[model samples]
Target: MPVEMKVLMNHIYEYQKGVRRMVLFTFNQKYEPAVVDRMRRLQLPFLLQPVGNGCLNLYFGRRECLDAVRMIVDKPLSRLTPEEDFILGAMLGYDLCAQCERYCERKCRRGHCGAAGA
Candidate 1:
């Protein structure tokens, strides 16, 4: 799927308007410094929560922040684990995994072994 950079920027802008802090998740360790610097420059308070296997969670101070994020990122809100979905909805006002494509063997965008044939 094509990523809409403009929409993403808008999401970020909207999120910043309502939140004091945000969380960012990344799969690339190399992107940590740069991403953090950018976030700081944007004046958005953020916490970097790193997960195993390059997953990074960006926590926002308000649910509105996540609503903006969902508008820009083309992921489905329904696909997220229940816990994650609830947190996102309650805190961010939107879900990020609703339309997200499942990682299958042949269609895995992350290229995981389990998705090799999906």
Candidate 2:
């Protein structure tokens, strides 16, 4: 249910250790046949390179890059590419949680995944 809800974030909370390399949003699935072409028509800075097995790879060098793409689009989050998913995940603090493994939403401290060995 939460994944399908509206995500209000405008940026990704990247945790880069050194120089900020581009953030990679990997989608394990691909869009519909014409979706890539439609994205191109919008003409944002995103370069949606096609990955094997019907996946899509989006690379972003800065938050502004994503902002530009979002600005020119009016579709619902579900209809957007994997970028939306990354945004929502960052907003929800999916990177880590400070508590239980499966139920908590807080960002995990240290290297623990809140699932013990997980």
Candidate 3:
């Protein structure tokens, strides 16, 4: 799906205001060049990863954050291990409790119920 310009600008505004250390923006692959140009003009560090089906995920933020992401995300987002998913969610500023619940749910589904609060 193509990302809306208003939404992208809102995320950019938040990043500029230090509201988040990183932001993930997904859009059609065709817009890659224009997005790259904007990121370069803004002097933001980013990693553009293809998410298949003519889409791309733009991970923009501190160089360190991107480096961490590079280590944890060698595969598709859907293929991340539960722990890796939790880490990614945390890094993206997701609610900790929700991440924990998601982590536990994923683990439980794999027969590791000891970690699930339920």
Clashes of each: 26, 4, 0
- Winner on TM-score between 1 and 3 is 3
TM-score of each: 0.42, 0.28, 0.92
Global Cα lDDT for candidate 3: 0.91
Instruction: Give candidate 1 regions above 4 Å deviation.
Output: 1-10, 17-27, 62-85, 95-118
- Model 3 Cα lDDT, one tens digit per residue, 22-55: 9998888888788888899999999999999999
lDDT of each: 0.49, 0.41, 0.91
Model 2 pairs in collision: 96-107, 96-108, 97-106, 97-108
- Stretches off by above 4 angstroms in model 2 are 1-11, 15-21, 29-44, 62-118
RMSD per prediction, one decimal? 11.2, 13.1, 2.5
Predicted candidate 2 versus true structure: per-residue lDDT over 1-118, tens digit per residue:
2221111011223423323333445454434334345335544244455556766655454457556544633454445434444444453345534223322322333233445473
Q: Assess candidate 2 and give its lDDT.
A: 0.41
User: Would you give me the overall lDDT of model 1?
Assistant: 0.49
- With candidate 1 superimposed using the best TM-score fit, by how many Å does residue 20's alpha carbon deviate from the native? 11
